[model samples]
Target: MALRPLFASLWRLLCSLKLAIVLAAAVTLLGIGGSLVMHFNPGVFGDLDRMILGRWWSTAGSAAPLLSWWVPVGALLLALLCLNTLCCFLDWARRIRYRWRKGGEYLIHLGFVLVLIAYFWGSLAGFRSEGNRLFVGQTLALPSLPGHFLRLEAFEPIFAENGRPVDMLSTVALLHGDNLLARQIVRTNTPLTWKGLAVFPGSFGRTVEGFAVHIAGVGRTSFSPGAELSLPDGLRLRVLNFLSDARRLAGGRVARGSSELGRPAFELELNHPDGPSWRGWYLLAEGPPSALTEAGLLLRPVEPLYRPYSILTINDDPGAALALTGGLAMLAGVLLALVSFYYKRGRGDRPEVW
Candidate 1:
């Protein structure tokens, strides 16, 4: 008999409207605090975008307690609010008689509960992988989808007259082993989605495709950037860097001037077994600088190849549909309730109590 009274007290507490108001206010306050923290210390919270929320709590969240302590507390309050909503809904359903007008109130409660549940589910199940670099004719295996691969077919960038990129388009194909599943042109706004996986075009940049080198008394050989070569004299030649649209700075340093190709340059490092290594920049526009001739080496640049690439972000969000459904349900419930209110007022009858 004593336990019965305690159970009744717990039930009343669970369905208390005052408890709901307090929880909502606390959640809002915590949200404001989190926003401020993120704005000032973006480096701490920035990793959350690329990680699963459930996993972030143990890693980044634990690493920065002062900034992220409110997240777990807010989540707990949300869970309590969800339970309270559910309890109030059940109490209302049990006491009130069913009517078409009352259906809207039920839907409102259910929708709110579902929205909370969706958030909780998504935080645990959803994941986001950002800044995946994909070059033309290269294939990247999907981390979320097994046996699925994303291949870059082509990339096109439209630049303004001032050399700023106005728009970018990437033609990508989704493949399963040797079979092609789907192909689409993904842009900044238009994301490709398949099997609940979304591929978004994040950004684009240029990369070195290959390099053509000519060694005197030896046949011309093709080399890629960052490749090392062994000379006949047992010297080592390393291609350290390649810059398209290269600009010569005041101190003889090279930098990328613009996106458009102007003067291509290569920074090479020559290593000798018994002597100090030599490093210098060789411009393609000017054939083999005097430094190479002074070193008694016959090396020349034939051509520099470069191409643009696309960075795609893949997102796996399983609770998106649930959230959408909850939003629609809430909208319908509000409209139905408004119509019922007007109808009751027209008839001059007492308005239904919520």
Candidate 2:
């Protein structure tokens, strides 16, 4: 009989609104502190969280087992808050069982519980996201999805008249083995979602690509169309056509205009009496050079051409739907609770709604 009274007292204490408020305040304070600490000291708490929670950790030295003192304390407080919320809900349910007019308050509690459930579920199973910057034709390996890779097929940037980029389009593909699973075009505001992953266009920048030819007397010089050079032996090397961005024209001639500098290329002709005349095309970005050594002369590429590319971020969240649902339910509950509290009332012995 004595134990029964003590149990009731403990249950009341657990179900009290004061306990809930204290726990909530503690969690909020802890979250603020954690955010500040993480902002100042990068990768410390991140590494610790990954190690303890077994979540995806991409930061450098994330494998190091170093935990902050506040992590366990904050976790304990969160667990207690969850328990308190559940106990309060049970108490509320019991009191409101006979009274059907106060259904809105019950809904409010239920929505909060659902939101908490989503948070816990996400913490346990959700993977961290990272951003990747890639050039066209470059492939990036995914850490979360093994045997799956993402490739950048093309990046198109729309520039304003002032030479400033205003919008970007990135085309990417998800491939497993030889099979392509999905293709996505990520835009400025539109994110592409595929296989529980989302790719968002982060930023864009231009890259230069062209051929740097080296001569016997001269160290190195950039070669473009209409460029004429006289060799030390009286022979002549002329760049017949230079295409910063080359595309095949109607008559099979390679040509480029001002807006075609995305893929640089060049075509050259060399005249030497001893070795006759040689002509070939050289693409700056990709493919093998047309001819390295010809006509008793050596012409090699200094470096590959450069082009613009988009930086994309890939993110995954399993609890996104759940969280969104809970948020909507909570909003609805709040509105209903306000209406019920102001309108509904009961007889003596019923506690006041505050």
Candidate 3:
């Protein structure tokens, strides 16, 4: 008999609205504190969205002590709030008979509980891979989704009148071994989804191919931009820069004209063992292969193989559907509650009954 009274008292405490209020307030305060911490120290928390919460805390918690302390406390408070919501709903159901007028209240509590559950579950189980770069015709294996691969078919960027990029489109194909499963165009805001996996086009950039040149003593060789090579007679050759479309300005200066393959040029530097170093630009459009009489270097621009690459982010969120359903249920509950209130007011019915 004494144990029964103790159990009853604990159940009553669990179902108390006061407990719900306390947990909500604690969670709100923790959110405010967390926001402040993240604002001041963005580097520590910037990658949190791309990590699994449970694993991140296990591995990175020690590295970021200032932000780690509140995670567990906030999680505990949210768990208590969920429990309180469930208990209150169950206690209310047990005391009153079923009625359509009270359906809205039940749905609100149920949706709130479901949303919390989804959040906790997703935080522990979600997977995210950010900044996966892929050149055209390159393939990346999806570790989260076994037997699947993402292939970049094409990358096209639309530039504005001033040569600024307005939008970038990436054509991607999803494959399973030798078979093609799906293909879609991924943009900045539009992501490609397949089998719970989301592929978002993060950004794009251009990369150099290589510069073909022939040294006086050494035979033909290809070197990429920023490459340093040792030539015959203790001479060092350095590829300074490469421009796809080189345009000569009025002041005898060269600038990139456009992204297209127009007048390609390679800036070369040759260092002598005991003399002054020589640097000059080799424009491929002027001639085929020419010798730099000053530096005794023969250079030719290789066909401009400027390849554009796309950076993609893949995410596998298991609880996204559940969270969406919960959100819809909450919206429906709010609308129903408002309708019930107005209907009762028009009839002059007792508010206590609702």
Candidate 4:
């Protein structure tokens, strides 16, 4: 048979409830296949920094990156959705013999289809995000898209110990241009929708947190290799490796090992330390001298402030809305078919004897 005939028949076959199960199964299998890879490999998280949410299916190793490959996989998944809709439309079109009952059912489903189409178009084109990195009372233009900009009313980041984030840094932003739409706060679960964009709260950035440091090595201390230090300026510096002939922080007046007592800090030997070996020792707020002198070096621990968070991933897929609408309509259409079939049979619209 011709391709059109075959497709039409296929769609007719698929219009049955069985086709929904098949599509759901296919989707489940796809998810399972992707989940297996992630379960086996622990190192994929490292690449997540470079990934765009959906690219985690294929492990790119050292190659050109998964987006070069996995994005097409995602595209294919979207294409399958078209098959799902064809079945629904075919089921409605098949009931040509009945008008009012079937037609009303069809109308409800057509409304559902409209919703689905809207979702599909909007999802593919609609962009969503929760935005702003500005401090309180500071204003920053927001953009749901490239041309859009939102002015910030405020942003806050409340945190816990070890720099673990407790809540999203809330930023109140306004529409940059004329009053097309008002502004609001977007948090996790709650999203602010304006024009075709829905901005949801994703997470907080490290830029809101204070400074931190790790002491990888103690130059001339009697302490072990693993120690952490926090600098006054708030820069978290790490010692990649130990340098030889590092200055020692030993004082006979107190004790040779007392550097671990009143002061639990590390003495840093600068790479540019000149003669007599200039070195600086920084202690915790509880330790010894605010600044200790060792050898003949004026060494100070360096602290750096937090870096700003720049980007957020926004998703606008037109298919989601369509799928939701189609789903609801499909349900109504199926129920109507069942009820109409039962009522007609019970009422004896035609006599059984021939």
List the global CA lDDT of all models: 0.81, 0.69, 0.79, 0.46
Query: Between 1 and 2, whose TM-score is larger?
Result: 1
TM-score of each: 0.70, 0.60, 0.70, 0.45
Candidate 4 local lDDT, residue 290: 28
User: C-alpha displacement of 197 in model 1, angstroms?
Assistant: 1.9
Clashing pairs in 1: none
Top lDDT prediction, candidate number = 1
Compared with the true structure, what per-residue lDDT tens digits does model 1 show for residues 8-125? Answer: 9899888887888899999999999898998888788888878878888888888999889999999999999999889978987887774444666667877888888887887898
Q: Across residues 55-142, which tens digit of lDDT does each residue of candidate 4 receive?
A: 3334453343442343345345544544554556555577555545555356554655566466446534544443334444554444
Candidate 2 per-residue lDDT, tens place, 1-354, comes to 899999998998887778888889999998888778767766565454433143533333344335344555776898888787777678778877575565666566666777776666666665555447789999988776788888999989988999998888888998886689989888888887764567788887665545677765656876755678877666788887666677656764676756545666678777775766777666655543434344345555676445677788776556667767767877887788687665664333344322
Candidate 1: segments with Cα more than 4 A from true spot: 1-5, 93-100, 178-181, 211-303, 344-354
Which pairs of residues clash in candidate 3, taking residues 3 or more apart in a chain or in different chains?
A: none
Q: What is the Cα-based lDDT of residue 285 in candidate 2? A: 56
Whole-structure CA lDDT of model 1? 0.81
Task: Indicate the TM-score of model 4.
Answer: 0.45
Off by over 4 Å in 2: 1-10, 32-67, 93-96, 137-141, 146-153, 173-183, 194-196, 206-304, 345-354
- How far out, in Å, is residue 48 in model 2? 10
Residue 194 deviation, candidate 3, in Å?
2.8
> Lowest lDDT 10-mer window, candidate 1?
345-354
